[model samples]
Target: MPIDQLVTLLENESIREALMIVYERSDGGTEELEWRDVRDALSSEQWGTLIEQEVLVSAGSGFAIAEPGRVERLLGGDDPSEDAGTDGIESPSWTTADKAAGAFALLLFAGYWNTGIRDIVASVESAIFGPVAGLVPFHLVIVFLAVVTGFYSTVLQSRLLDREKLEQYKQRMTDLQERTAAAKERGDEEALERLQEERMAAAGDQLGMFKLQFRPMVWIMLLTIPVFLWLRWKVRGGHLGTGETGLVVPIAGAVTWQQSLVGPMQTWLVWYFCCSMAARQLIQKVFGLRTGTSS
Candidate 1:
């Protein structure tokens, strides 16, 4: 299934609820569930969509997970048998020592940033840009931070999400979808239905991959927020102050009180977003962080 279609299916409240109900009743096992298990949670339209989308299919007078192994793995089920594609060594399950080490590392990062990184970043910004109005160069500092954050975020995502693994999941989904289409063309309704269910399971795996990819950002924000606060504090003075809003295009120019895509928003904020988005792509490419199929 295309990502957009899968996203639309997953976004439906009733469908989401129905999936949850089915998952609960199945107890992460092979137990089949009748429509009665999810009927209350799903509307007729939702049920129809699930069937049409191959997210649900008839099985022995009831319904079972389209691809139990894939679905189970996507849902992060504890059972190892749920995902044959996954290797034990590639799992994210951390030992107690690993958890302790991670905690210590985060604490150290926080302390280091609060104590020295702020001053160093500010100094570097000033040395490069020569103070573009505020206590320090606001745009320059933010842009630098944006690049730093982008590089680190990409690294974290690559390490944590396992791009190659996600690519394999996507490939499996594509193969299943092709098989489903072939079955439908050959008038094999039973095969088609089964294939559709399997395709849906692949969709679940795609969703899981997305979740894992984004999880690193949340963890990164734990450090990002404090660093942003420090930067804000450092930039609070002179004519520009923190209240001043402006559009800054590197090597071009800056304009205060200018309109952006959303009219009348803070120019600096808009500029930050624009710069961040562009910089992330550039950094990702430069670092060879572009995971073709996975992304």
Candidate 2:
């Protein structure tokens, strides 16, 4: 329907109020509203207009939303949980015991793989530069590790997240917000109220999407924490003594007054942070990872 026609229909406070009531009642099946409930608010003429517009249909003793799904969508899409009530949380009902067993096996394999990688990583470290200047070889290894971790995490996150669907929901919520503001500006109290209700429902959906996005983090962290601990042991050699640079930068090898970027920070923590930040962007691009704030 055209905006003008919709506005004309809704211009009547009674009709607007009736629609809101019907929308609120419109759930699983077709919503049925009796004349007694809305008769005091809406006149026979207004009710007839609504019926003629096909927004409402006679069903035995009451009227129901004609196309409940479409109207609900226009009112702001229904919550996905309305049907299944999962609220974006993963349902274990369909996950068979076999699938659960497979996941446990995968987790065990990851633990074993991480333990075996330490020696291999050390070999890679030794071969790369064959004992370069103070911490330079170690720095190279740190960069390489950071890049690998970045790529792995980004790809895993993308695989776990329904980013396209999340983005679409966000866009729709934003559009609804804009429409709500327009209604408020025009002093359409009924429309504003209905839009606000819709926006709140959309917010719930967005929260659910965000929860799904982080669902993979539990698995990722399980593997990553052990690997990082090993890296920490290698880099710090189980301890950090003063005046020992973890990774020395060749160009500005020493932390001088001129090189304030690092600001006298010479620990593995700082090195890892710098490398991770630098490599994350490149790795995200290579893996086609999405970077954006969830609404």
- TM-score, cand. 2 vs. native: 0.49
Q: Write the per-residue lDDT of candidate 1 for residues 53-85, one digit (tens) a residue.
A: 765655566655554434444445344332333
Can you give the lDDT of residue 83 in candidate 1? 34
User: Per-residue lDDT of 1-295 in model 2, one digit per residue for the tens?
Assistant: 3333554666667777767766775452244687776676667887787778756756556766543443554445344343222233332221254345446545544543565654554455445433442455555666766777777766767666666656655656665665555444445555566666655645566566655555555456644554555555454443323434444466656542123445564456567777877888887766667655342
lDDT of each: 0.56, 0.56
Candidate 1 differs from the real structure by a C-alpha RMSD in angstroms, to one decimal, of 15.5
Q: In model 2, where is the ten-residue run with the lowest total lDDT?
A: 85-94
lDDT: worst 10-residue window of model 1: 80-89
Clashing pairs in 2: none
Best by TM-score: 2
